[model samples]
Target chain A: MLSPGIMGRSLLDKVWDLHTVRELPSGQTQLFIGLHLIHEVTSPQAFAALRDAGGAAAGPPGHHAGGAAAGPLGHKAGLRVRRPDRTFATVDHIIPTDSQARPLGDALAEEMLQHLERNCAEHGIAFFGPGSGKQGIVHVIGPELGLTQPGMTIACGDSHTSTHGAFGAVAFGIGTSQVRDVLATQCLAMARPRVRRIDVAGKLSPGVYAKDVILAIIRRLGVKGGIGYAYEYGGPVIDAMTLEERMTVCNMSIEGGARCGYINPDEATFAYLRGREFAPQGEAFERAVQWWRGIASDPDAVYDDRIELDGARLAPTVTFGITPGQSVGVDEPIPSPADVPADERAGIEEALAFMALEPGKPITGTPIDVAFIGSCTNGRISDLREAARVAQLGTVAPGVRTFVVPGSQEVQRQAEAEGLPAVFRAAGFDWREPGCSMCLAMNPDKLRGRELCASTSNRNFKGRQGSPTGRTLLMSPAMVAAAAIRGHVVDVREEL
Target chain B: MSSEAKVERVEGRGCVLRGDDIDTDRIIPARFLRCVTFDGIGAHAFEDDRLQAKGNHALDDPRFAGASILLVGRNFGCGSSREHAPQALWRFGFQAFVGESFAEIFFGNCVAMGLPCVTLPRAELTRLMDSVDLDPQQRLVLDLASGTITSKLGTQAIAMPDGARRQLLEGAWDATAVLLAGGDAIDATADSLPYVRGFAA
Candidate 1:
């Protein structure tokens, strides 16, 4: 047991202690998972593994709960979904946002979805199927539906699960094997990471968004910098960010090598969760707020490490290379391979050659073949509103393909109600339904050969946008909107 | 698939990939992840990179054929928590990894599958990589009990969390049954928490 008063402790330390089920003999903490989120791409294999492990003594497949006793195969098909009430399922990664037709066009995708649907049905877990108006990127829907809350440990198959940490929770992504672990035992074996407080002092400039703020952080701290640490985002700048903005920041914490990231719960967090579908109601909500407030890092909290940044000085940043950490400000020239240390030159050269970029040239004015403004990173209503505002400035340029995919069905509904879709459509940006459309390009949406894109999605890695030789420059949604209009990378500030 | 599987030692030839932040997307392209299962994923490991390199990539190199120990640079496997990445490597015949560092989720996935992932300082890893490259058939042994990687040339101290080391040594890397054994504690913890109880104050 931990004494919060004996020593000033961080939010991570407090929340972790609360969720510790027991310490395993392996010297890892057997942390209880409060909420386990699963998607189509990752869950099928896990369920199959469970079925294989459950065997005949566990009963026939699809035998679960009360049904385990009634099935002809016998009373234990081994539907080992411990705490089904705590688990939620959705179809995202592989679902096509372009169509809502039953039995997906891709037979393989259809089969995967069927497996998930069947598994969820047998286990008595909730599934946000297509047209359910709840299906979306796992990270986006979790917070919107209020399944993500403060002082909870949230795990999902998708890497962007860190998005839930914006609610002042301990959230991280897990692999399918761990997903199986959670499904079978409702717990994960994990080692506690050291806490690092990243203080972003001062206010950001007019054109800079939360996306840029995160890009700036990743650029300063290399992709591997946070390997063994959890980032606690704070200071004046973070205090001023809205909940959605905070989500955008935390969503890419994985890109910076931190599996988990969080901001202290405040009135903004409480306000955002107050009336959501699953949040505690009435007096219970107020009591929950008190608990959330107490879990925040104490004033005298000790941290393993501390980092400070002047957010006011950050510009509209864009990644010009493979990793998110390889980025630069809009007006700044790309660093020459010769300028960096010898050990890093190879990586720089690889990026430059792959991106077909010349060192020392400013990234501004680089032509783009396509523009995308959606992903878990910047697909909320606020992101759409921001991009829509820029969309009103001008129509998309000739020969520059553009798409604006909403993060979730709720976000799409809100944007449509606000006429944001019409604004985008009029600007020549294809307004699409909710799903992670072009972020990883797993579905129908993809880039043609050797194309360059200005994207709002996370990860500018090689072939990330579907074309093996395609290039991606990641920026804020507004920047993506500006690029769509101009047919090249331009500062959103100038467009405004 | 059984809990009896242990990974105390991984001794085999080493394959070297010298790059930082080598991401999962490059390891196994998203296009290959459309399958319902991880079967045959090994053939597609580094699909795009191998295509671009025209069989010149380490995974494609004939000299390192059947190598089971992977030597990589810093932050190896740094994107996407897709277990498919490690599954691909495991299927491709890799049993252990020695790198300057590794992404947390990727490392955990490897551990869950009973693979041993250890780290070394950048210089030490470079030396191991260089020695292995000069003689592709060189054998390396990673012993969790001793916390060192040994080779014909020399032995170097390796670093991994003691907990992970213990898990590998004790064959308890399959965590489901172990965690499920503590059902009472899990329920007690869940009950004591306010959120699961609807925030009863």
Candidate 2:
């Protein structure tokens, strides 16, 4: 019974309507994907399924006649892999950043990498490998190379694929099978999420970054607050942010329980795309910009729900527990079990036990054994520059292992050209290549048992850092740099 | 057509596990997430830590051999929106998930693929996991027909959100079922709505 002329529609509604294939009886829309990104970690099985189905169709009369011929044939094909052009593959999770040598040290890692390389080549899909200059974290390369743009629907196997939303795209992470489905059909049937507007008015304080804004938002809204909603981040603060800073905020949208988060395309967005590699040339670019401008939410846009935040009131924040929502300001004390909500009390207690922290204690002085400043979430050149600025000021504490990993080869090269790597090395930190180093521990960078680390990555779930008992303290990259310098979780603002 | 289509029942005893924030990587590591076939994923589910643990064999562990339902603690399936987590559970013979809560993407994917996820009180989940741990052979029954979860030790009725429950009962995914449910009314609405024409292209 809804009217079509709902005066002002948000960007989410505009994109949703434009891409919706049809409305079904279930009230969900069948959405067509514009872009699908795959990685080694999630697509091999899908291709195999496609081949098995094709093989079944092309079999000879006696192919299935004998016992030996049919002896436990490990195959079934329901997936189609014909549309390789719609899919792109990248090596991130399992590739070690320290070495560009041919054979990866871990046999399993090497096998996965090789499988992806072979599969992409066999299917005619473009792949960004370790040696490829374009190679970096899947999320980073897409935007930096102008592959991700306004009004497109992008999907990837990795969760942070939502990072593409900063470019005014509707992006979400999918599972392996879903990745396969997109590889086959370049479409997915998805239920449209209700739109929520998160308005952050006013200017941010000096030294506060996009990471601080997102952490503050997550802290206010419980980790599960945005369930079933697509968040539209707007107002003065969001409008003023650079494209990369906006990406950092939207990248962690999943952590705040939103399906995805985005800002409307504006002059900043158009300017960011103006000179990028894959951006449309000359007149085409101007026409594309017009279309993009039309899609931005009107001044009087309506949303199912709206929440307003004051940007000036926020400060650099850090998580005290396993969940991203379990965070406090850098200067604040960790909440005691009694202070937690009744529904979350048990989880809080469990996190406390696992982290071995006392309630009401300040996290600022908590000792750390390791400091990691890289991940798809916060491993860009700006993040590196911020950390390097801190590193250049002081040396890493003795006995503390510090690693500074850029998000991509381009980021590494750019940092090296800026002498950021030298700054890190002088501060006693290991400056490494890209490829998701120490983020999820698929590579050599991992925490030993019971080692406490100040990490800039997204998740801090038990055993997430490789060792079952390893403890991770989630913080901003600058905070991690400060922690590395002091061998403890020190407030970066105080150090500044 | 007669309503005599044979229904395949996915039935088995449930093995309960209690843990918070069990990520997709833990359910099925990114390494094992590659294959297209759902087959054998069940065997390798939880391969990373479960197989690496001393004196433990996750695949051969009889306690979870044929479990059709999983009872878990808060924030089940929290990290990563990897669809393989639910696919692995489905392949492992789990038809239903009982937890205090679920990650949004995990819950959405489960619903789309016909995997039933039920949320109950944390106390109920704690009790269920405790009982199952005490007796490995304890059997739990999840009745989608009645919207109830019962075990030899206790029974708890669950309330699924109206939309999702209806979707499951009708065995419908995507928007086709919604339109079909509305039948002539949807057609009439579509005809009346002029803006629908703008979206056609």
Candidate 3:
């Protein structure tokens, strides 16, 4: 076992150094990507990029063998990807989360889904298709299946791919070209991002889950606060959280504008990964745990920046406006322009105007036409359990549409095994299949007209949930369930 | 693998969008993501905002209708990892964007698609935005070779990191091309990985 010396490095640096295959002539590192997770939305073009290269002599102009090197420095274009085990995919973004009926109503979505199926089949890549039962949100399936592990560098086309970092890996969301880059070659050329240590110490008060804690951090940091840095979350609060809770925290790293976010592996992380389908077995499992533990940051690891927050001070937070950063505690008021910093005032005002929210009005009791509990952020079983606890109390308020989407089929099965679905349905919630529903509205689950929603999803961007004028209130699932019951945004703490 | 794609400079009419942190969601809503290709998304660029403001959104304004060069405030394209955001802009005829700042992922995505995202000093950005917003017909020139955005506001030093600037001017962002070009080295790296064997993977 290795002992910590006086000088210590952050977990991100440790993972980054281990994953570097080689540094390119341009000084960029060729990061050896351990896992490449893709969805229907981003994989099509990447696969096309591959086929185009194979037929460079007789392909489209974009598919030229050597890319049109009209510039000073020539570029590389041919793709020779032969590794299939390293790639995994699923259909979540464009699939309906509630049902599996063939001949989907949206033909374009169906086409995209079918294209993904064909691409995966042709490539020999593992595809968790509609009937696989293993199918679910890419982020959810990866963790539950033991695919996301410590000491690995994972990349996905979706921004929320940062969720894997909870296991102490350097996971990040890459663009489609990078997706093709990884597919064609199991490496992503990249400059490393600096690290920012976010420390939230102390035990959380009752009713404040990991979701609230992350929302609080995003609130303080603002959306662009982490633009050029990777975030390392630690301290008593994060350390005390369950694996699912940790994932919920790291999921929104992209929303904070950070490339990725991670927590060092520990006993809890080992416990979560042990005995899983993909995790090493028997003695190998013990060896894997040892390696995972060895990768944790040293006691005195240095960081590019550090932020300290008191977890006890955070309340159930909700976004009152367009961006995730424009949030406040459920009990707090929609901040007036004068209250926010001068630079942020314009954005705050713009959000207020778009939301039809008045300054100084309490964020609580803002009418919500929809209450959705889904997305990679808060769609895990614990999220379902917490929301079900509230739903078990009472039926939903009349005329308020609500959905409870499990993050994965496995999660849905677990929720069903525990009768969570019955509790939600009894309370007038539409408990649906596991997929990213209402989160991005790629599926049929969506908001309509100028309806305002209380969402457990990560983003509250304009039209995030489908309707152009629809407003979103980002909060925890329990808070979303409470909102469904009350027909407006309300603190789950009071309900509890 | 190599690329012929290049962006030495961009010459087109300039338009101004006066907001910071304009995210990918705002640029191209998720509803438009169902297609196999990034076709027709250009028409729906800022579709949600354009609809919400009853066609009064900046992208909807008739004055900037034909503008191919977008001048934005800081932190443009802040949210989402979707390359569709830049692709949509490309389809909409955006050759380059000169903003006060850009999100790392958004800038990288743009660079991959051969779109130049350059930043300028706050004062220069203000002058450019005001000038373009006042006259949509103003021809704006973004010279990546010299790192300058020229218009009636004159040539102001556009701030782009040496690496990103090199990436754009050299057409080196075709990552798959670059990776494939590495060829045997990539295969050798794969062969050397401990967990990369038949079942180890």
Candidate 4:
């Protein structure tokens, strides 16, 4: 890497610089938003806010989609927004994972979905409604359709939007107000975060997946440690990961208290985006690939802070507490409060009580009532293949409820194509369709009273899996599969 | 930079909530996230836990009821990117907060919503919380312009980032204003993007 004063720049800097429209008097940059990905949960209030401000959604400056007449451009009408093409909506977070049936059983969920659908329609924006074959978790489908690209600034109302940064884009999770800002102006006013380069070198051991890698990082850096910084994940391990694997790592950057985490674009990135649905075509595609590769950090780029880690020494890990920071290797014993920092003692106590676990007990045999393997973090094809491989090795433990929810219809289709769904079903796991699923548990799939679940989804906070008293342990999909086989949290290292 | 009327001060009873790393999950549970609008979310703030604990949770305690100023421990609102957390607190009648520290997202969300989250040193934070705890009726005043929090017991200067403090004091945290102010440039930028095209193209 470059010395502190060297001029070589990273992709994060280039993307940020390219997107900087102007610096406002408030010292926040007026950053042009290249992409706005919305979902059922966060866009309704924003759209309503737009309309309340006496502004209508405007199409691209001089153009209209679907013959919908364009409104006054930008924020001209006290609250106008331009560029419908830049905004895309998908029905996720609150959609039913079991079926595409209309008017879902949950009235609130159905209402949110309807609002999202209507808002997108009235705005002349694209909506990937359920059964459209494109509807899925917003993060999953963005990259699936090649909407996420290098050198762009992407914003989503959900925290996992950092997943898009795997393409070398500068992406962030904004609150509802900021979502409205992007909708009304195609830009956001925000201070830039310092860059923290986290280097996880050495090759990953078998069964120690990207989920483990990210979890390990979050464990090393306290959940709040990344505050005010953008994480630039690099080193041999990151470079060796596939596009989807990289997405998994970047997906939980928010869990680390970092707004965004990114990997430098390389041959691997362009190869994944090549010929995909929204990716450039023919000569255009080649030209785009060149631009993508060029955005990679120079060999001698600098960072505000650097952390080094070794991936090869890691084991399949699982969270034993509420926050993602309380993770430990599957083979390790649950840590006692005494073993933790004084600041974290209370959290450990609370988590141990909430999860109904003792401090010194090993998590390996910690009984689990459910196994949920899905979320933007790990519901992609490679994640499914790893889980499926383990499913083929054993059957779901008796009385254990196992659900394999795909991240998207596209992922579901690919999983089915590879016969992974059959493998899951044969092992007594309910192979379900797409959406956020039990990750956030807005849909039908949820935990019952005080049930402990091994989940591949992020965030194991109390009630995160739907039941207020239910417990969740965050782990890799393969670990979840192994847990399903054993009826408890287990090490995928041996099972795989 | 903003057309919003500047805020100079706020005065109210103080409600103390002591706990570090009290995350958004405790602030507003996910099950309550289904509304098209954030209405009545305050009632459900700390929903499940409030119910489970026989109504002893901070948001449920009668001591903090209807109190507009909240005093909390370190790392308050540390999980999830849900704006509902602040919306719930806003609906719960909390106008300002004094804390040891705050999660970046929660702090940013509060500032954007015209809610001030000012930090105090740990010793001073304890004094603030203790004073609030000693008398639920204790009145506190937050002067945004002066960066001071005054209570019947004492007065202390709060530490806030200059950027956030400016917005809070100016009432300029209204992002809509900034967004609208840049309308022409925003439109021009949109016009230049290849992906941003008229359907007719």
Which one wins on TM-score?
Answer: 1
Q: lDDT (0-100) at residue A409 of candidate 2? A: 87
Give one digit per residue, the lDDT tens place, for model 4 in B91-148: 9888888898888778878877888888999889898888788888878999877888
Give the candidate number with the greatest lDDT: 1
Tens-digit lDDT track of model 2 for A131-245? 7788888998888887788887888877888899998899988766466556544556567788889889999976678888888888788777776788899999999999888
* TM-score for each of the candidates: 0.97, 0.85, 0.94, 0.94
Per-residue C-alpha lDDT of model 3 across residues B1-201, encoded as one tens digit per residue: 256776689898987888888988889999888888866878988887777679778777899877788888878898788898988888887888888889888888887777888888877788888888787888888898987878887788888866667776777766555655565666666665444542242
lDDT of 4 by residue, A31-99 (tens): 899999998877778888777664233323443210123364333333434568788989888888777
TM-score of chain A of 3: 0.94
- Sorting all predicted structures by DockQ, with the top scorer first, yields 1, 3, 4, 2
Model 1 lDDT per residue over B39-150, tens place = 9999999999989999799998898999999999999998899999999999999999999999999999998999988999998888889899999898898988889999
Sort the predicted structures by TM-score, highest score first. 1, 4, 3, 2
Q: Per-residue lDDT tens digits of candidate 3, residues A1-496?
A: 4465556877778777777777765567777888889899987887777666643532234422223341122323334344677888898888886676787778988898899888787667898987888999999999999998897889999899999999998897988888887876778888889999999988898888898899899888988889789999999999999999999999998888898999999999989988888877777777677777778988888888999999989888888889988888878888999998887889989999989999998988788899888889998999999999999888999999888889888998999899988898888899888888898888898889889998889988888888877889898888889989998887788888
Error of 2 at B118 (Å): 3.2
User: Where does model 3 exceed 4 Å of error?
Assistant: A1-6, A55-80, B191-193, B197-201
Chain B: TM-scores of all predictions: 0.97, 0.75, 0.91, 0.87
